[model samples]
Target: MDDERLRPTQLPLNDLATAYVQAGQTLFLAILDDIAARVRLAHPEAAYLEIGIDADGDVELHGIWSAQESAIGTCRLLYDPHDDPEQEWRDGPLDLDELVDDLGRVLTGSFLHHWGVVEPHPVYEHRDRRWLVLPPADRAATVAAIVRGHVPDAESLICRFAERGERIAVGFEQVTLSGGGTISVPCPLCSPETEDGPWPRDVSHELARILGQLYALPHLRGRHLTPCVDITAEHEGQLWQLVFPYRDHKKGAESS
Candidate 1:
């Protein structure tokens, strides 16, 4: 077999295809901005909002109230399609005012639960309106909350790492709207084998997968540029630390 023939082919995009992709990206950003604006209007006291969009277009919104350090109100919007076949295949009419009102109610309930006025429900249960009241001083619980707030199936991911006798701690060192920033993941098992060794393939792969989900986050997609994450992992009982920089390849040029 010829050497060139064995290699994979790269397909070139025409002008129309390029335009189509650009249009889709622009519309996606617009929708995210609209949702964010609504959330802000509803909960002016929210310190920061974390939004997660799934493959099915369902949206998960979490508003973290800074005043109540341990309070988080969660709301999920299921993608409802128009029932009429003759109509264009699109989402049904969504009442923004009603949605915000419901979110307010959930936040109120969360506050009541925090103050011991209402009984708290199980954290693992799935509900349309849920409140997570975390312990302010617990680092591991806070890490788990951050992971669960953004990633789908976060519990499973955490359990998987635990099963391997590894604990993962993620910190956002710096994040910008231009998709440029650093995420620090400190874990002994994810560290490189040697000082001058190459980046750990397993760790990089897992981080890349998680970043793909995070890329859809409204706060990070400002310039549509691929973001880079700097991971620093230290081995257990070791004094030295290794820094591995991983670039997300979802879009834009790779960073060195």
Candidate 2:
């Protein structure tokens, strides 16, 4: 298609984008409400879901997964009408109806996973892959099992832990670096108070030990997956880097 044809001509399409995002957000909030009810029954002070929309029209879905706020996750979705695919009229001049359908599909597929309402999407190898849109209420064995279908040869799983409703954040980069690639994981919880603020040494060691054990399982095993961990923590006006060599489950485990 020509450049002109690639551009969406109607402003109404922008409204359509807004509608899709709104509908998705509504559905997402309802699901979270149910979660809060169940969680509060046992822990009346349970953490609740919250939504944030930036000026650029990007939607951020984030919240704590427990009363103690042990697990924290966020998923960002793009909904700018002027952006590509939204602007680039595909096949023909953009059809508002079709655009709305596309927007709905993308939103529905992703908004739930962050809330733990559904399993994390299956695709993980690629850093930028749009996962298949799954139907609502589809449960799974474990969050890890969601991607068990795809066993990647080499993977860098960025896991974050937060407590006390995001006031405190701890992140771990569990890497099985392959093909001589290097990675540096930045702390997501970056604030003046948190910056240069050191997390205790014991907490770092404990997190590393737990992650090492988790990924060492048979289901998570990969041929190219090596056992090496580089942990980063920011505190006291400095960034701390810790290297934990993977120990093999049997003899020579750490050297593996």
Candidate 3:
């Protein structure tokens, strides 16, 4: 058989990608529903929940309940993707019993009252899916860490742009596995004050490239699979709002 003839066509590849994405999305949503049910049962007043994974692969679940006073409690869980080959793309464990117990203990303990008022992050609806946006401070910190770690030169260029009163914004408007992703960066030179100086298109492009890679970072992707609905950053007047392509096991798993 000819090697070229044996190769899969683009349509088949695309179909495979779509199927993989749907599978991951379905499993993720099911897990979210389970978590919500478990948490609500323990704390009937629980109105909001946020799950986050840190660089060390530790999973933290935070639940908030409102009565005359608002209270927040956090519980940590271990998540090792290597433990389950069948569900490697998932961010947390398939089991929720341990997680629920942990949250229950914390919410009932004295620690719950110490934490100040807890505010829920804004939620955005897209089709049948709803995702929470990270707080601006957290989002900015994460973006800065990613850019500095991946694209070192971006930090300095951003600083220079800030000094000159020019802002550089790098973000993704959309990304798809089949390819034609859109990266959004407002033109710094277009600003009246920046017209007198040169714009560093190279740095902007590099920043955009690095931002696109976020979809593949396992630690960043929470239990929801999609990290957040939007990631925005601001440094000395420079602001960025990034929305990367959804990554499924088809590409994300291979990269990981």
User: What TM-score against the true fold does each predicted structure earn?
Assistant: 0.25, 0.22, 0.27
Model 2, range 158-252, lDDT digits (tens) per residue?
A: 45433222122335443334454544433434432343312343444434433332232223223322443324444322222222333235874
User: What are the per-residue Cα lDDT tens digits for candidate 3 across 64-135?
Assistant: 333324246332222322446685444332345476444343333222221211233333431222122111
Positional deviation of 120 in candidate 2, in angstroms?
6.4
User: How far off is residue 135 in model 1, in Å?
Assistant: 23
Please give the range of 10 consecutive residues that has the lowest summed lDDT in model 3. Answer: 159-168
Please give the lDDT score for candidate 3.
0.36
- What is candidate 1's lDDT per residue for 124-196, written digit by digit as tens? 3533434332222322343333443443223212111111111122222222212333233333354434332
Per-candidate Cα lDDT values, in order, are: 0.34, 0.36, 0.36
Better of 2 and 3 by TM-score: 3
Model 1 clash count equals 0
Candidate 1 residue 12 C-alpha distance from true site, Å = 4.5
